[model samples]
Target: MHLYGCPMTRSTRVAWVLEEAGLDYHYTVIDLKSGEGFKPPFINLNPSGKVPALVDGDLILTESAAIGIYIADKVPAAGLIPAVGTSERALHDQWCFFASSELEQPLWLMAKHTFAFPPDQRCPAVLPSAEWEFKRQLKVLAQGLGDKTFILGEQFTVADVLLSHILTWATRGLKMDLGDEKLEAYRQRTQARPALAKAREREAHEAALKAQAQ
Candidate 1:
């Protein structure tokens, strides 16, 4: 299997899931900044030219949330997601969609205005409202995580892997106040996982590779 993504992006979540699943796969970096992501067959792999596209034999997949769930199913022992056909599975699906649609959507908007587009093309004023939307949705997540180590109580499922990357990125981008204690603590706990640590190390190494080419 192979994963195509750059370092430290949301792709990190997919990498974390792959690591947690104990899967051996190759990581092919796509240098988005230099436009390598928009070139050649990478565009064929994903029309949006997004990172974290997974290739498993004949199977190819994209979307961070989709990749997270796929990895969970691939390695059931990891318990990254609840088994299908149960109440927990339904809740798992709910949280995954919430993270993507409710939480991540605003972050993407803010990201574009803050950094993605050229400075002249960007809307400086959008940051505040975008951040506001991000915070508003995060409040629901904070409430759900109250006194729990992860989204699904004690267990760290695919939901945590899916959303933690967003929460961590939001922390850096908005420098928004992390108001909820349990949610903040939960973020810290999951990030301290060996799989996450290893993912960071690997990502750092990948970054160095990209830098060396420059």
Candidate 2:
């Protein structure tokens, strides 16, 4: 298995999941900032020209959430997900969708307007609305979390991975107020995991290697 990624992006989610599953995989660095992702070689793998594309022998998967789920399901013994037909598994998929769509949407919108877009095309007006929407959505997530150690009650499944990672992104990238102490603590707890640390360390190491080569 191989995963292509750029540091400080959604690809970290995939890396984290792979690390948690204790899977051995190749990590390829794609310089998205340098327009490397738009080139034919990488584009051929994911026509969308996105980071966090996974290649597993004959199968190529794009999108960070899909890659994370695939990795988790592939390694069921790691217990990253609930039983196949259980209600917990349904909740797991639900939160993953919520994180990727409801939570991540505004964050990406804010990012696109703030820096992802070319200066002339950026809309400063979008930031306020995006931040507002993010806060509103964050409240729903906080209520969902309640007092559970993880999303589905106790086990640290990929649902927590998906949600926690996006919360981290919102906290660090958008500067939006998470508005709940428990949520913040939850983020801290998930990030403090050894697998997450390894993923981050690997990302930093690969990023540094790329920097030196440049």
Candidate 3:
């Protein structure tokens, strides 16, 4: 398996899952900042010109959450996801959707308004409303999390990966306070996982190599 990613992007989530599952995969840094993502091969892999595209033999997967789910399913023994058709799996799906659609939306919007969009395209006026939306969604997340060690009880599933990743992006990348103890604790605990640490190190190493080659 091979992963095309940029350091500190959504690709980190998939890399974390692969590391957790102890999968052997090659990592390629797609220099999106240099317009490499929009060029030939990378553009062919993902027309959207985004990072975090996975190539496993004949199957090419895009979307970080989908790639994480595929990796988790490939290694069931890792217990990164619940059994299909089970209620636990349904809840896992719920959390994944919640993280991507609800929790992550505001953060992404904030990023766009802050720096992702060109100066003329950015709207600073929307930032306050986006922050409000993020806080509202965060309250919902806290309710859903309740008092579980992981999103699905004691088991650490891909759902936790998605949730924790988004939470980390919110707190660290966006510099927004979690505003709830449970959510903040959850972020710290999940991020401290050895697999995540290894994933971060791997991405950093690959990024450095890419920089030298350039």
Off by over 4 Å in 3: none
* Comparison by lDDT, 2 against 3, better one: 3
Among the numbered candidates, top lDDT falls to 3
Pick the winner on lDDT between candidates 1 and 2.
2
Could you tell me how far off, in angstroms, the CA of residue 160 lies in candidate 2 after the best superposition? 1.2
Q: What's the number of clashes in each of the models?
A: 1, 0, 0
lDDT per model, in order? Answer: 0.85, 0.89, 0.94
Q: What is the C-alpha local distance difference test score of candidate 2?
A: 0.89
Which of the numbered candidates is closest to the native, going by highest TM-score?
3
lDDT per residue, candidate 2, 57-171, as tens digits?
9999998888888889999999998878998888899999999889889989988898888999999998888888888988898899899888888889887888888888888
Deviating ranges (above 4 Å) for candidate 2: none
Question: Cα RMSDs of all predictions?
Answer: 1.5, 1.1, 0.7
Pairs clashing in candidate 2?
Answer: none
